[model samples]
Target: MDSLNIEPTEFTPRINFDPENNLFEISGFSRPENVIGFFRPILKWLDEYSDSVLSRNIDFNKSLLTVNLRMTYFNSASSKFILDILLEFMKYHSRGNEILINWYYEEGDDEIQESGEEISDMLGYPFDFIPY
Candidate 1:
């Protein structure tokens, strides 16, 4: 029942780390002054969680990791930090663990859809885009 749930604030993104269910979610805007400082802990959490899960889940016959993202927009500076997060998750995917990332965007957002495509191309991470 390990979880790290952080509420959304004016300067930070919301984080819901539910390892027991293998359901992690990150949403809200991210234009913080120090993006590195904000996301560093989340990245660290993921790393440690990876180690713990690998040790306990020998067969991995349980739930899989599902990252649900619904970011409206992000600043140019935050892009790199977010990129790191995606890459970390991709590692789990590469290891044969089921990884599902859902990218939700508002309707009629061609730019966002195209950006999603760019991300899929850049990271080679398969994402299911859902229009809202």
Candidate 2:
């Protein structure tokens, strides 16, 4: 499958989704004017990836999906979409997929860490909190 790479902008984040390498990352700030429009393609890509995985009979056990989130700030609307994205991974995990989420935050950034914790808790998935 082709990878999805969206450049970061003043009001958006950088997205890098590589299925071949099992690496998915979203970094930078997210405060787009149209939240849904900014994230719709990502959600669609995830859905397609899920379908392809199933249709291709990929081995869930051996496929390790790594998700890295390095967001410094985001608006309330973006938060909802971020949660939705994580929930999608949760569903993939529930289906016996090996997944690891790394939430990266700057040093001494309590808010970001807290947000990550909250999201991880909501998704019922364990995430490694990495302070950089």
Candidate 3:
């Protein structure tokens, strides 16, 4: 599957999805005026990628999928969308895919760390929280 790269804007985060390298990253701030519009394509891409992987009979056990989330800030609406994205990854992982989620937060930022913990707890996924 082709990669999906979206440049970061003042109100949106940068999205980089590279299947070849098995790296998926979303960083920066997210407060898009149209939250749903901003995330629809991303969700679609994940669905397509999941389909592709399933159809190709790929061995996810041998390859790991790494997802990095380094958000400095995000609005409430964006938070919901962010969870949706993570849930997609959770689905992929539930299907016996080897996946790791790395949640990065700035040092001294308790809010971000708590947010990651909350999401991790909700999804029942053990995420690696890296404080920079």
Scored by TM-score, the top model is: 2
Please list the residue runs of candidate 2 whose C-alpha ends up more than 4 Å from where it truly belongs after superposition.
58-60
Task: List, residue by residue over 1-132, the lDDT tens digit for candidate 2.
Answer: 899999999999999999989899999999999999999999999999988863475554557789999999988899999999988888877777789999999999999999999998988889999999
Worst 10 residues of 2 by lDDT: 53-62
lDDT of 3 by residue, 56-127 (tens): 755545467899999999888988888999999888777767789999999999988999998899888899
Task: Kindly indicate the candidate among 2 and 3 with the higher TM-score.
Answer: 2
Q: Score residue 117 of candidate 1 by CA lDDT.
A: 76
Best by lDDT: 2
Positional deviation of residue 106's Cα in model 2 after best superposition, in angstroms: 0.3
lDDT of each: 0.80, 0.91, 0.90
Off by over 4 Å in 1: 60-62
TM-score of each: 0.90, 0.95, 0.94
lDDT of 1 by residue, 20-132 (tens): 78888888777888888888888998888888884466784645789888877777677777778889888887776788988888899887677777877899877999999
Better structure of 1 and 3 per lDDT: 3
**lDDT for predicted candidate 2 compared with the true structure:** 0.91
lDDT of 3: 0.90
Backbone clash total, candidate 2? 0
